[model samples]
Target: MVNNKTCPGCGVMLPNKNLEFSDQYNASGECIQLYHELSANFIMSPDVTFRTQHAVDAYGAQHSGNRVKNIRTAFSLIGLYLAVEREYTGRQVQHAHMELAKRNIKWSSFILPIRPYALSVADVLNIVEVKRNEMLMEWSKNVWDTWENYHEWTRNICKSYLKHF
Candidate 1:
């Protein structure tokens, strides 16, 4: 008594009567569950920017003001450091920068990506801080001796960067 139906989990056509006995019949599968949740939330969200016409007409809003100034400054500094570091290490920094620019990722989207590189510098800093804190906490037990050595290596890398700067 198998009825034709769709296996919502993997989007495969199956028997409707077998769906109850199948282990992969979920409509909201794990593959797209998170994306669906995010899309739904975004659809119901309101636009609150003061610069928008709706906000201005409703509440006489003022300028929204610049938000990414500090972040931009930090990114510039980081980019300069990276450039200097690459030159000091005999790497083709200009070529890399040009390639990135060719991909339409200049100063604007260089620090951002669609997925993997989308993380901000602040996020990297937070991760570094967490590792440092963990190392410090375990220093008394000598558990982070190797970690401390790794920090020294990173410091040397930065020193080489500063040399070219």
Candidate 2:
């Protein structure tokens, strides 16, 4: 029997259902997972000042989607070196998060999804840290190299970001 249940993630009616016998059903069998499209038109506004630490935090919370553009604008007028380094630093964090998605899986420790997309930069960093630690614990010798790479990637990003200040 087909349940025709609604998928929560995609909000679509799917073909998930029961197989004969004991009427056991799989709700997620026909789920349509939705990909989060990046925020649109993030750089339309004027450049925000990153002079103060508060401004930096606010920018991360409010304009994380358009980080590169804003950083370029704000720093081009104030400090070009900072602009370039920030872009480099931000891009690295973004890349590491993307790579984390493909390798994320949990059985023994059951780590949840990091959900790096569609979130503020601070939230993304926080969630990714949690997931990274979980992955570190679960990683065996076979996957140790990949895990180390991710760790080093984030560490370097932090170093680059700090260089801006």
TM-score versus the correct structure, for each prediction? 0.17, 0.18
In angstroms, give how far residue 90 of model 1 lies from its true place. 11
User: What local lDDT score does residue 85 receive in model 1, on the 0 to 100 scale?
Assistant: 29
lDDT of 2 by residue, 42-62 (tens): 223232432222222222222
Judge candidate 1 at residue 111 and give its lDDT.
Answer: 23
Residue 161's lDDT in candidate 2: 40
